[model samples]
Target chain A: MGEESKKELTLSVSAPSGTSKEDHASRRTFIKNLAIAGAVIGTNALVAKKVASVVLEKDPQRAYLEDVLPGDRVMMAREYVVMTDEEKKRLVKTLIENYKKRLG
Target chain B: MKREDKKTTIEKNIEGSTRRDFLKKTGSLSVAGLAGVATLMTGTKDAQARVTWAEWFQTNYRLMTEEEKREAIERLEKRYSEEYGKKVTVDGRPAQKNVLFGYALNIQKCIGCRRCVKACVKENNQSRHDPEIEWIRVIRMEKGKFSAEDMDKGYPSDYGIQVGGNAYKNAGVVLEGQHYYQPERVPEKDAFYFPIQCMQCEKPPCVKVCPVRTTYREPDGIVVIDYNWCIGCRMCMGACPYWARRFNWGEPNLPKEEMNPDTHYLGNRPRMKGVVEKCTFCLQRTRKGRYTACVEVCPVGARKFGNLLDPESEVRRILERKRVFRLRVDLNTFPKFFYFID
Candidate 1:
């Protein structure tokens, strides 16, 4: 028997009683593509979701600023306790002034 | 003789009346004093003071109401300020509201000099007693072989010696040859010092396991636990693959002299007993546009922390340039933590 005819005989024997050639080919292609798509989309989605959430919500520079202050530097920058009304106003004014300066 | 006897009788009667009066006053005072003492004892052993491990297991650490969280923050801030003599602002702003933090470490460059570890302890108000509250731990591991067991054999002998013979002292040692091995060190190379902390995983198991939703991933990939909301259930600790989370067994042993007063609502303020804590990526510092304490204190430029979204950020550049790998990639935790071996 020729090789092609022998392959055809094997397929016919293995095939379900009524399965079509087109159906088998399409199923094979679908499974292959589905796997490829799953891998590509799965990883991309995971990384993108995390990055997007962080970028959308967090101010990276601000977070850095809050963390970088040395012990001595923080002491020098002395966060004033808002105890008395006068102290509260002073602190508020200082913060506003600093913000304005930075914006400028 | 009769007159004298009358006088003596009168004196005896007066003494008996005085004794009765004294007894009545003493009886009233004793009752009042006992009541006061009882109240004082109850105050010490109030509902807030009775913390048990079983109670902790049942209590949800994450499901605190806003009011409860605020009260906790207030208490933390007060404690810090009192101890440190500096004003600490416990910002209760939502993680997405104002601040963001990210972290990175280069395994190739870290020399295992535990400066970052000490710095984190000091900066984060970590308990002197436990020293495990802050979000950093240096894990030594072997190259080619990834498991801890492979590195244990080489660990003891590698102390204080650089990877190359004493020749490369003071110069930046790049892993050029196979002979380079980490010496006996707290953090050693050959064995890479993987400083593992909150991976802030995209799908944080800590957040999922939290019964009260006290611990949640912020909009910026930072996972935070509301200490007030946390009923000290150590579910977060159990769920953490990196072993980054810690539970306060007692009131945080903060000495008045060593507290950092510049606090953030979601970041390092003095923590209370019975709350689980991990690294917030130094949110207080990061929120204000600064580097994390560990990153800043690293004598070698091993630690890099920045926005992964920013292509220009140091973290992004390292990720792009190096063959970086996250811990436990098999688990699909999607940890923000990364490491590179040269």
Candidate 2:
């Protein structure tokens, strides 16, 4: 496979009519430079898009601590899980009833 | 045949193969395998294939050498910083000499506000959403006792024998307690709060039952779990009398903005799925001569923490002056946490 690829490369280098070795080298360099420039511009554009999104963020606004209701704060728990008021009330009732039964 | 010619003849006779080709192929294969392993070991950002591969092979925190411990902490810090979108520090501070930590809670004064529970979750960086994890749980117990006025009241049901009861209510009856109790406001007229957390037992049953030996009591009397070493067998959860251990039932959902960047390796650091975590007495703060988050945030000053070895410490004073008792003393766990009634 290495020999075949080397033979193909030699054939291509020799087949170009009126194209000097230096001309071929210069053309290869130009293509390489063009690729590098394209890559840089592409990367910059992507980065700019990301920065724009961050700068002009469309995320939903969050409530300030003072604005949030006490009841809501009690429910939110700073992301911790908490039972709903109804669930808690139900459980409390059951607990009181159990105690009442024990008393009886 | 001559020896050289015989060797040449044997090589020619072997169908579709040569000695050089075999060596070359095997050599290239070994080199490729080594390069692949090197890439994984050195790490790459492709697929964000970071320290996880190396992390799986790490030894238990107790067994790691100083250098290994530093590297592990650095690895974790990098991973957490990348994951949380902030600089995260994973502290590896060991227990201090001659400092046995103790905690005392004024059960009578707790208002059932559960602020300590929330503060603990915030400071410890517990899972936020799905498997919401809070180290402290405040239990509401309705105040009930015998009354001299209720001597002839019958039972609510007809079957059971009648004990002492008031006309409309019962006497000498205490409810088991409620963990899901949430009121419009706390400090109800008929209720008192009892908050429970890891007692940091002197002889932790959790440590005894842990199949992987991942959880252990530190010299400072703070029981901690090496989350990485835990096999998620949950034997320790069953063995704990306090019901303090919480299992990560699913992947933890800690948001980047809410994540606590300051973390201790065995204490309040963000945990992975399938590991059992519990209160570590907030060793991250406590070991640094600061109070636990619960103690710091207790509105009623009900929670107290200090060095048990120091007689001047608040915990020691509480133990000496206040009517203090450890929970489940019959279990012989010798928990460092004390409940005091003023």
Highest lDDT scorer: 2
Please state the error at residue A4 of candidate 1 in Å: 99
lDDT of 1: 0.60
lDDT of 2 by residue, A17-90 (tens): 22443464565567557757966996799799899967864322121111112222232122212234453344
What is candidate 2's DockQ?
Answer: 0.01
Candidate 1 local lDDT, B178-197, one digit each (tens):
12233565454344444566
Deviation in Å, model 2, residue B195 alpha carbon: 0.7
- lDDT string, candidate 2, B147-175, tens digits: 55665665555666554465444321223
Clashes of 2: 1
Candidate 2's displacement at residue B106, Å, is 0.6
Docking class of 1: incorrect
The true-versus-predicted C-alpha distance at residue B138 of model 2, in Å, is 1.0
Q: Against the hidden reference, what TM-scores do the models get?
A: 0.52, 0.65
RMSD of each: 32.6, 16.7
TM-score for candidate 2, please give it.
0.65
lDDT of each: 0.60, 0.73
